[model samples]
Target chain A: MLAEGRIWKFGDDIDTDLIIPARFLNVSEASALARNCFADLRPDFAASVRSGDILVAGNNFGCGSSREHAPLAIKAAGIAVIIARSFARIFYRNAFNIGLPLIESAEASEGLAEGEKSRVDLSAGTILRISDGARFTAKPVPDFMAGIIRAGGLVPYTIERIKAGS
Target chain B: MPMTITEKILAAHSEKEVLSPGDLVQVKVDMALANDITAPIAIKVFGEIGRESVFHRDKVALVADHFVPNKDIASAEQVRIARDFARRHKITHYYEGGDVGIEHVLLPEKGLVLPGQVVIGADSHTCTYGGLGAFSTGVGSTDLGVIMATGEIWLKAPPTIRVNYEGRLNPFVGGKDLILHLIGMIGVEGALYSALEFGGAVIEAMPMYQRLTMANMAIEAGGKNGIVEPDEITKAFVKERGPEAEAGAVYYRSDPDAVYERVITVNVSDFGPQVAFPHSPANIRDISESGTVLLDQVFIGSCTNGSLEDLRDAASVLKGHRAARDIRLIVIPGSPRIYMEAIREGIIETFMEAGAVIGPPCCGPCLGGHMGILASGERALATTNRNFIGRMGHPESEVYLGNPFVAAASAVLGRIGAPGEL
Candidate 1:
């Protein structure tokens, strides 16, 4: 899948509490959570984010909390994809399990600037800056994870498996 | 093939004889847990999975700890959904009301998680069970929902990072300091996607409660799990729980020749009380080096360090002196059992006499869920894990992390000071 969007850059260790605080976790509805996305760290994130915007962050993006609400809120807030230098273990799993694609590219994380339009080719693992025509390569998503994303996340993937009696 | 303890546990559960890091395998889960916050979402996904009931009633645990005693209408509704789901499935390990405690603390205290088991929970700190030699890790709610249906989870075997702590520990320095020092040294992502095998002389002498505290914050360092190999201390602790606790237990240790992705060694004798300053657990400094930062609140609880021993540590410092007039000191025991033990030992009386508020055995303000949230520009020093932005309350509010002694002494001094000051 290819995603073209404006970039929203964030720094290292963009923790779950920063993405969606525990105060907002009482409600699990995607839309309700989306309204509070980055409510504390980036107060304007929820209201100003446009559809298909790509988030570019430094290392350990989505550290702290195993709350899937973090990724769900970001996805519902109209973030199409994320590119980070690296990701916390659970956050990486949560994002893919919810079908939100993430790319790991130190070069792209350093090169991408906020509000700059960019194009990301998820399957190809390439991130291109439209303004400078700079291209960066990302570590490919593992095959098994890609399959889950292809099935639109783990729920549908597991549904298919159970139906097939696996 | 020589395998680390983590590899051995995963291989034992999976249909494989040997495994390596990054090898994806489906392993049977001996225990699956979800709390009020994560369980509602998992229950919703379980419905989408079209499961009639959970794969196994007794193997699944549902606890209402976070935002419980029902923080508000929304939190009450969330817990109700988890309650209904638990009742519908007749989940035997379901806990709520007075019976509920932090899931990580309550589960092991009840002997639900045992050695060499593959445990999964919807909460990140589920790795806490690794202190018992279990191969436990956290998963998202949807992943947990599927695990509830199938009683299995797919995971890539994580590489192992062995941390060796040697030398005699200084007085008042314990597991919280050790773990905080490690996080500070490694940064948050230093051990990303790897199991941290904590070993060496210091760990061997460490008590179970302290070991659990170290394991509980593994996620803070981006670790898949933090584990201490089951030894005589582990066996004795499990044996105290009951014969049932040891029924299916397996004690596995890393082979002498086990391969590790990396090895980190520390000498504890040279260390002092450590603290993680605001907004990040990795922003650490030794107590002497930490500047005089005043506090608005002092919290001593959570799955991380809310055991009976932790309360005793705090009470020892607060036995005679009261909290500083302007400071708020809140203490929540990890579980009802721990709370009752504290009362029997006069620890509760000591806290109350010191003008402290003793909250019920729940998560409390550790997650900013309820009971003593901070206002803007306020600061708190807590014994709980995680000090992320706005973790204890408003975004502008800051949090510092330390052991129970530092928390108590800080309360008395009304600033970030050490027990030595008293």
Candidate 2:
């Protein structure tokens, strides 16, 4: 449950259209969306992003569209987790439903800078700045949501639940 | 303890004795829907889950309005996937080809959504059903995929925000203006995770179509859903829509002592048609204050304002005058049904004679998919929801959101003027 990665920082209201424009919504494949992640606002994002990278952003990340392409693209692009000051309600649920972890930490969102190395301890809900060693606590994922993430998304979670029988 | 309308509906659907704000509950879904843009992903996830079949065949609906005619190869592939899934699963309400329409508009029109239903769709404007007193909300494709497999969803009940509307609206000012004014008062994320319950004399007296339009924009203010308690008007409409609608209807009203997170009152008597300028739906201004802003295109369509009444209102403004020289006027009916009705009412002919280009019933330009994308630096006025940057076309292009009256008058004037100005 611990993730160590370099940070990719963004500002407020990073909308889904910017993450994956409706123009690219033709295919449902995560990789297709990953290729165009941040295509509008940050064209170089797809080419430069490496696996296990972490995304940090200010408030209202993933606003606008109800499309899950934003989080799917980010996860497929190999971003380990997203840390934001706040997130749009639908996006937050989508991220978890798809097994993409997100942490809400105003302190971490303000403390972390672009391309900085960071270690996120999901179990402890704490993030450590690699360079400065400053640590900030993130809100813990709700117990049920954590269960869904553990099962690797809602689909798998639902499958497990169905197999268990009420 | 008194419960809000949302809480009451959620509790009923979950079969729980009661529910309060922030309580986590698993609720049985009455209806689940997705469009071409979202259905592909949900279908993929549904397959990955390895479920034998959908939880309930009749409770699911899929539509292909977003890219109905297939804007491109990718969109065509997506539509094909959705079509294949629908046919393979034997979904009851699969809509495509001549029958296709925007899911939100089409669902209520066909009487699929009813009062007290806990409906969910993979589109933000699913809140439009709340106008019918249903507890409908938008979710993601992943959530929809799960809903397809198991007709249940986990939701944290949201606190209610009551919006009280009073006074009369000026001519040409309607639901679009009222919603714009509310979004202006509260920023885009003002009602985050909150249910917006619209009430008071004005909304009660408003027509059903206008109520749908008003509820459609609830997401613009980041509300989880928007609802109006069912009354005689709603009951009459439901009864006429037929026995299926009335049989499914289960109306619930908020208790008098129900607690609300916030209460905002809007006085509409003195208001004019308000416009949401470029980049955000919350950046609103009265039409009179935003004078002489020339337009490259004027679009009237989308689930937001493409109903028959919306077309009639626009036709009323464009009856004699033609669109300004060099300006393009694009009109799209919300559905094939609405298209036929508009034609029967002579609304389409008025639009054509007035120099407007009539497109088929599909959602394209509203999301910058196709049909009328803006060029760089171009300015277009539209009756659709969401005036976000690049919403209609090029990022540099701008979209001004207004009601049908403002959109039609602006088309005739080739500027951002009001119907009164014409």
Candidate 3:
């Protein structure tokens, strides 16, 4: 799914703690988590976010602790894609596993304005700046991951695979 | 081409006869684990599956850590459910206070964990066992519970990220600090969804126990696992625990031209005991730089910092002074084994005589469920992993996170201080 959205800018290493701090960890539901996404690092995040927004962050968008709640919260909060210079390992996997698109583009973090709208082309592996005609190449997803996305995430894809064999 | 050890294990289990990065495969788990925090939820989901339990009984481990000596009914009930579930499922090797330590520490130490085995723990630190050459990772409770009942889970093999840290460690700068430095450079997610291969002189120079600490924190930076190539140090670690653990042991190295999604080089000598201020482990600062933080308590425990060496470091600074009367210092050994060794060496008595409370071997104040939690507006310094607000107790309580020496010196000053300042 291709979507055009404004940038939600973040600084270096916006960790899981910033996204959904450990204090909120006891609560397991994703809906409750949306209230606290970037609550610590950016207190106004929830109010500032628009539907189908893209988070453009300087290095390490999701780092510190393997809390799945972090990405689940961002997805529930209407974030379309997270374009970062780098992604923390576990969160990257968790994001894609849950069907959240994360693209890596250095310019997205540096060149894009917070309110700037951008088009993320999943199949083309490109993020086009609608406001500035700037284009950035996102690292291509491996063919296997592409299949999981086509199948709509790990749990659904896994269930489908198991059922197909049965 | 000769296969890597990881490739061998994956190929053996792949139904498609080929394994590649991001290829989701449901393979057999060598072991599955859960702790007090994650176990209850896992049990709930495992029961929901309505599936018959087929997992090997001996391959599951459960440890009561986070809220041990239960401070409240929620934690108390969490353990009770896990305790009953462990029994119902015939899941033997459930380790508690005396036999139990941090899941990461207790697993490898008890010889239950072996190399080349695929281990899954509901806790994030499950990746720690990769230090022993296992393809270990963490998952959510629902995922873990399914694996518990079915003995299988899906994995999307990640691209490798190789970090070659070469050089001798500066004195008293432990693996905890080094990993913190790496997190700073990597910004926590540079190695996302990848295996971190740690090699070169710096890793080799670290002892087995230290390597375990490093691996445990790998998950903190969002890695699936952090692995150190098995060496003589690893062999000695297995041998010292009174068992031949080599049967399941395996080692992996990077190909000369092995493609890495990212490669980071770090220098440990320049780094010192780092602390996270406010919250989040990534809020790192050198110990010496945090000269003005006032303290209410200093904690030394958890699978991460409660080793013999860590205890010794704390005791060294604490020998001459008492903790500030208002500041509480708590030290818990990771395992009963480490506790026994520390007692024999008089570390426990030293701490006790210094007005520190010695809790049982368990995770305390790290996840902030119970024991040593700070009060609102009060401050404390800790050696635990996360320093996130309310992570060690009250959401308003402040935690200044540091390593053992920094915590100890801060304990002496009743505020944050560098190691040698005392």
Candidate 3 on B1-422: residue-level lDDT in tens? 43343554555655656555666777888889888766776676667555566367898888887667766665577688888887887788787645678777777878888766788887778878777767788876656766776778777777777777866676557778887777667745556677777777888877876777777777766777877767788777777655457665655544465566667788766767777787666678887676687778889887778788888888887886788777899998878888999999998888888889998888877776567767788887877777765667666778776778777777777888876776
| Model 3: CA > 4 A from native | A1-12, A30-58, A74-86, A98-143, A146-153, B2-27, B40-50, B71-84, B95-100, B149-169, B184-186, B241-246, B251-293, B375-379, B388-401
On residues B1-422, what C-alpha lDDT tens digit does candidate 1 reach at each position?
Answer: 99999999999999999999989999999999999999998999899889898999999999999998998999999999999998888999999999988898899899999989999999999999889999999989988999999999999999999999999898789999999999999989988999999999999989999999999999999999999999999999899889999887899999999999999999988879999998889999999999989999999999999998999999999899899998999999999999999999999999999999999989999999999999999999999999998999998899999999999999999999998899
Complex DockQ, candidate 1:
0.89
The TM-score values for the models, in the order shown, are 0.99, 0.98, 0.81
Model 1: residues with Cα > 4 Å off, grouped in runs: none
lDDT of 3 at A158: 52
Candidate 3, residue B136: how far the Cα is off, in Å: 2.5
- Whole-model Cα lDDT per candidate? 0.94, 0.90, 0.75
Which is the winner by TM-score between candidate 2 and candidate 3?
2
Residue range B268-350, candidate 2, lDDT tens digits: 98678999998888899988788679899999999999888999999999999899996899999988999999999889999
Q: In model 2, how many backbone clashes occur? A: 0
Query: Candidate 2 residues A13-46, lDDT tens each?
Result: 7888888888888888889889999887888999
Q: What TM-score between 0 and 1 does chain B of candidate 3 receive?
A: 0.93
Candidate that would win on TM-score: 1
lDDT of 2: 0.90
Task: Return whichever of 1 and 3 wins on TM-score.
Answer: 1
Q: Compute the TM-score of each model's chain A versus the native chain A and list the values.
A: 0.98, 0.97, 0.94
